[model samples]
Target: MKTVSIRNPGMSWDIAANILVPPGFDEGKRYPAVISNHPIGSCKEQTAGNVYGAALATAGFVVIVPDASFQGGSGGEPRWLEDPEQRVRDYRDVVDYAQSLPFVDPERIGMLGICGGGGYSIKATIIDKRIKALVSITGVNFGRLMREGFSNFDPLGALEGMAAQRTAENGGAKEDINIFVPGSVEEAKAAGIKDIDVLGATDYYRNRCPAEGAGTRMLVSHAAPAVAWDAFAFAETLLTQPLMVVFGDKPGGFGAYRDGMEIYGRAASKDKELVVIEGWSHYDLYDNAVPTGIALDRLVPFFKRHLSDMPAGSATNPAEANH
Candidate 1:
């Protein structure tokens, strides 16, 4: 995979992305493409690129993994601002970039969004018909998550605090940020914290797959928009593309399992499927090899089936194709 910068005209900034092409890729041949989006507070290199992007490319599709604007390698101000609108736009902009490529078949473009990106992808697919298919892994609707809160978090109280923090920043105070994962597993254990999502995220982000520019932090003021935004605002009417929602059975504080079930039921797409990988938690789908393999087993064929017609001599099934 090689790094490239795509200009986001709306934001007037460049989005840094990693492009992975199938082996023996030829520019003369138009290939199906997938836009793989990462989770919030994460970069392209984590699960999006290193795991799904690599696997999708090897399965005979061109894949692009982009770091969301205002985070990771992408350009934006007030870093770590989790604006749902901007996050949704990032998917459209990436689609624009993908469609501009000479080798990518514009009509065959698909999307793979993990965690927060999954929510944004659903929103993006609602309006952007360019996305022919969508696969969401452990999708989380941030708006609902923020409004309802986790571990007895008070949304209204947090909003009041954010309002105060914004006022302070306007008055030249240092920006206040919220840590995504507050403590380590040992610390959580000592504190008697039993939220599986928190424990799993702490282990994955801190110990399992830490990356530069992928810190677990976000601007506190971002809650204002996040609390109001909904990833599936008009899915009953607008979301008509082929959709596949995947999530583990285990429930967690993040509510991905809930969001997955909701989207699966609400989507208007007749060609949608809800895949529940039993015995796995939300974070287990992030980088756990066993669960990840199970996800890929479904994902590879889903994209191939919905994206576009395969080339003349390529393997019909993804499993039969030798990477």
Candidate 2:
């Protein structure tokens, strides 16, 4: 595993990423690659994205996990601001860097987008054909989540609030409104946070996955565009690549599970599969040992089947090879 920085010209920020090469990697031989993307307000070191990269490297693929532009170890101004389109472009830029590596096979590149990163990955795949296979782990549509609060509670109210924030921003008010972070589990519970998304997120962000640059906040002005964006805008038409959607089926995870299934339904790909990891919350899919271990197992075979060719001398079928 090695950490490196790459320049992203237009965004005015350098992307810092962690790369993992398969054991016994050789410059002479090309290998399939996977670009793993982290969630909004998160960095490459986050649990799901980096863990998957490490696991995939163990399974014979080169994996790179990067901090999105303008966040974490990456460069950019207005530090915690979220740009939907720019984030999508970041994926393409990462792909460009990945393909430049001596040991990476340009033709066999794939991506896994975790949480909000999943939305950007979907858009990136739609726009860039270089991404061959796609995986979304507990993916969320941030635009929708921004316009309509998680679980679709009072969507109109959310949008109205965004309008107010936009007005204040236009008047030169700089306010960063943080969401989903409660000082303690008891506070989150007291705030009527029954949904596992917020509850699980609060637990992970506060206790489990702490990073110096990470916070549960976004610039107030980030709302307007996020509300206008859509991760699945063209899924019913343009998303034609092999797709895999994994979600947790436990109590706190149903919303994401249902959303992923909808994406599977809407995707034009005939080769899509939805797998549900039972008995875990949404955040459990992030770093919890047992469930994530199961997820890595499912991902390895799916990626291998799509990203590599059949072994040169191996049998296509037992009977045919014997005969």
lDDT for each of the candidates? 0.88, 0.79
What are the TM-scores, per candidate, against the unseen true structure?
Answer: 0.94, 0.89
**Candidate 2 structure quality by residue, lDDT tens digits, 158-236:** 6677778778878998775766468778898997878777778878888888887675677665555777788888888
| Candidate 1 lDDT, 1-323, residue by residue in tens | 89999999856689999999999999888799999999988899999888999999999999999998899999999888888899888889899888777777766789999999999999999999978899999999988988886314787787888899899999999998888885688987788879999899889888899999796788986558888788998999999999999999999999998899999999999999889999999899999999999999998999989875634324443233323
TM-score of 2: 0.89
At residue 32, candidate 2 shows an lDDT of: 86
Model 1 TM-score, 2 decimals = 0.94
Error of 1 at 207 (Å): 0.8
- Model 2, residue 265: C-alpha shift (Å): 0.3
